[model samples]
Target: MSSSSEEDLLFAVALLANEEEEKRERKVWVHNIYEKRETYGEFHHLFPDLLKDRSKFFHYFRMSQEKFYELLNLVKPCVERENTTFRRAVPCEERLAVCLRFLATGNSFRTLAFSYRLGETSVRRIVYDVCDAVWTKLVPIFMPQPDKEIWERNELEFRERWNFPNCVGAMDGKHVVFDKPANSGSLFYNYKKSFSIVLLALVDANYKFVMVDVGALGKNSDGGIFSNSIFGRKLQQNKLDFPPDKILPGTNELMPHVIVADEAFPLQRNLMRPYPGDESKRNTEKRIYNYRHSRARNTCEDSFGILSKKFRIYQRKMQVSPEHMTKFVLATCVLHNFLREDHPNLLAELIEEATPALQDLRGTGGTYTGSALRIRDRFKDYFSSHAGSVEWQERMINVGRRNTNE
Candidate 1:
């Protein structure tokens, strides 16, 4: 109990505490294999070899090396980070490559972390940051707000390429499945019995996304989702800069520029759905209208098909949060549009020869306004008229009927 004995005891306790703290700090900042990424990572070792073989490079990144650099240059300002005294930041090119590979292969962060020689958490953060940058920088360039001229151009392409008049774009929704988040029960569950978020898109005739609304709950019907989306609200408010009504090709009757969709969407003055019921199928004029509608709407179907097949991320359930998944989906769409113009052959090969028609999610019970009904009628009449009819229309209709009967 002497003062000298107490001082010695206090010194001993302080020495033990310092040793324990040192152990904890060493565990927290331990050196690992990932620290040698500059020498061992795929980006450092394998990517240079890939550049020598263009085909392999394209397959690895889902884009040409040139395109990859171009994209990096575009998004560099947003994704680039400053280095600190502790460590240098991951290069912008490497960050973009990590994101593109994640989207191209849908690989998990653990798998990507090992391949890139980075921490799993670091991989996840890089994927999200690069995806956000891609969406922000590319969307305005690739999928800008459409004005009257853009809408008119799309209408002309639809008429020339798909044989549908007064149509600006084909509208549809795709369910991007993902793992259910904690505490989110049944909100993201769809009739397909999977958790998903809707990617509601309006695709142009050229298989490019004109506008997309991502991150709606899967349980909601496409109609409801579209009605609640920002794009849909702008459409409803007549603020989308759509061209005024114009006369149909070869007809004196004026019709509004309309978006063609399946029955999941309600019929509106600016939207058209096919004539329903067995009665319409029996009528030749109605049959022709449906045929043309399907032909034009097939663009949207093909866009989804190409996107899913090329990106491959939508093929599996994503593991990220819904917010991050939205960014991922939007980035993929921007890339789809960007690649569509320059790499048409590549995208063309991804299209399924016969993508089955999407089922009608909404039954035939909703009321249609008189104006909407009349707009559809005018289109039906136009398709059957001489000016709008293609030469092989009857033959195609007969073939479809025969196939159905058989």
Candidate 2:
């Protein structure tokens, strides 16, 4: 063919290609949402007026107006965008609102896309960015940065409020359930028949999470997770901000400030666990010690209960990766502490989610050191003494025998 014939063919092809590209770009598709998601944009866009109705306000945002505004302001610098000539940028308020709704409801990006009036892809980026920002900006504020002063304060709160002496925090492990990832084995799968990532946390007396070591395999036992965790390793190496030795409530002998947990954590001088009921000793004193330890340990249990209830997403399995799920857990925990300021009852609504066996007081797989055993003895002695005994202690001891008799 001649050069002119080839040029004509190439020109025609270029014009057709441009026409196809424009047609694809200009095509408009619409869906019928059936009005279910109407509240998605309206209440979020029209705030203070909607804030007057507390139930409606909280039902959507999962946080009060004041708290939402406070968070919006805190994350505004990171999430807010500058408008360009191309199209107007998404406002900071809307960006944060999109994330809050995602965390609050655990709805899919597609489901929230309709509610927030954005593409599913946009919603995905917004959710991830806001979660990252919240964890980065707010973690330092909400998470307890323990030191000498903070540790002492925690001990005081645990003693005065929970009636367990010299306790710093209640530590526990929770499996944040998620779907098995493609191309992965049983690595993330647990005995519960679901894939999950573990969140090993130390919760203070006030139901606030003090420290968290997340992203452990769900199949790992709590003791295993703790021993392998950053917080656990630090505690073992004596590198954390644990307070110096303090005198026992009734004795002149000084003991290390410690965290109370069930048998799932290894017993360290700085960490206390309950006595194994099946072992050699089932004596009344040991029983009393177990009772007192359970009292302190319940703080962690109650913390998880409140956490799961407040963030209903935790109750269901997530579709994200283990890494992203860790972010979600940390973000929820930060919000949990922030919201607890206003709704401080701990509102233990989802206590029934985990079984007693899952929450069991199994001793950590680590060998018990002599000093750790001594700490347990010291606490046991204190609980039996007049200085540490609550008015209900004796009755609680008797009630145990009564249950056995029945």
Candidate 3:
């Protein structure tokens, strides 16, 4: 982030370099070539060597060779533009590669320009343009569209994989910090004591983001931000194609399909949060219910973790406009899903351990409907009974009690 921000001060200089730098200074290499180009040059030449050295490939590019090619092919059409009589355009492959490197490292345009043999101004333009293009072309194909069939499939998978029934997706919000924007005082300032925007994401059981809402200010509660988003409005108005209310696996009582979240979101017929207070600790059933709910909701947290640890940009504060940062969120999410589909081994390392930190469980949300409360109760009852209880959930809860000496 510091490297990138320092380069930001030189943006105007980059814009002026072609006219001033060479004019004032005698002779320097016109083409900014660096050592990375020797190895990073061409896929036809480099990819084979990269495949033979998978560890080096993952270290340098942070993706498999095939996955890189897939993304190159995906974004090429959108970012590629033909050159006319003016001159030959920069190759589509180079443009895509530069953007990927920037996203992968959050490196300065200065570093990218020299490393990729392009001018600084050109590198800056290419990277962000490809970012916008990636979001535009690939998002619809990769990010889950909130339709009934999709929702139902996601819910079924959550049940099959996590033993948590009636769950459509695991939803959560992550506050992405950024440097302050010009003339904006504290509108974007968050309780984290940073200027930021939040990315509200919903990932399915398999780690694909089924739904993502970006560009919310950092100051608002997750519930408030969610309630104000377009998806939230559609959700509240029943415009999204949520599955019809259905009976539990063994029970006669019908329950509406819902998204599971931490307590920072509202509990509704269509959204579920965990049981609250000392009762959840003292009561075995409620304790088991909280464990189930948290385990299911942890999918979203795991997805966020995978993204942060992989992308490494969200690991630091982004230095761009909130709107620009939204594009980053969108593109990374789409690419995250695309990579999840294309390369199962990409996130294999941390797949087993994706539990969120205890800090995530700290907040509370709004009062929901009586029906919502009853629906939660119904789930609680079902999970405690033989009809929905996991084979070892009671044992796990008991073990946890022993660990805490409760």
**Model 2 lDDT tens row, 2-74:** 9999999999999999999988765543334423334555434566466788656666677777788999888
Model 2 lDDT on a 0 to 1 scale:
0.77
Best by lDDT: 1
lDDT of 2 at 260: 89
lDDT of 3 by residue, 1-406 (tens): 6988889868867878867866655343444353335455454356457679866676556677777777778777788889865345777876877777777777777776766666788887887899898888787788747788998898889899999888888988888777898888888878867787888888899988988888888777767888898877877898888888888898787888888988788888888889886779778788888889988998988888777766756655656788877777788888888877544564565333333221232275887999889888888989999889989898988886688886
Off by over 4 Å in 3: 1-52, 84-87, 349-362
Q: Which candidate is the best by TM-score?
A: 1
The list of candidate 2 runs beyond 4 A from truth reads: 1-7, 10-13, 16-49, 279-281, 344-364
Q: Weakest 10 consecutive residues, lDDT, candidate 2?
A: 353-362
Q: What is the lDDT of residue 201 in candidate 1?
A: 90
RMSD of each candidate relative to the true structure = 2.7, 3.6, 9.3
lDDT agreement with native, every candidate: 0.85, 0.77, 0.77
TM-score of each: 0.92, 0.89, 0.84
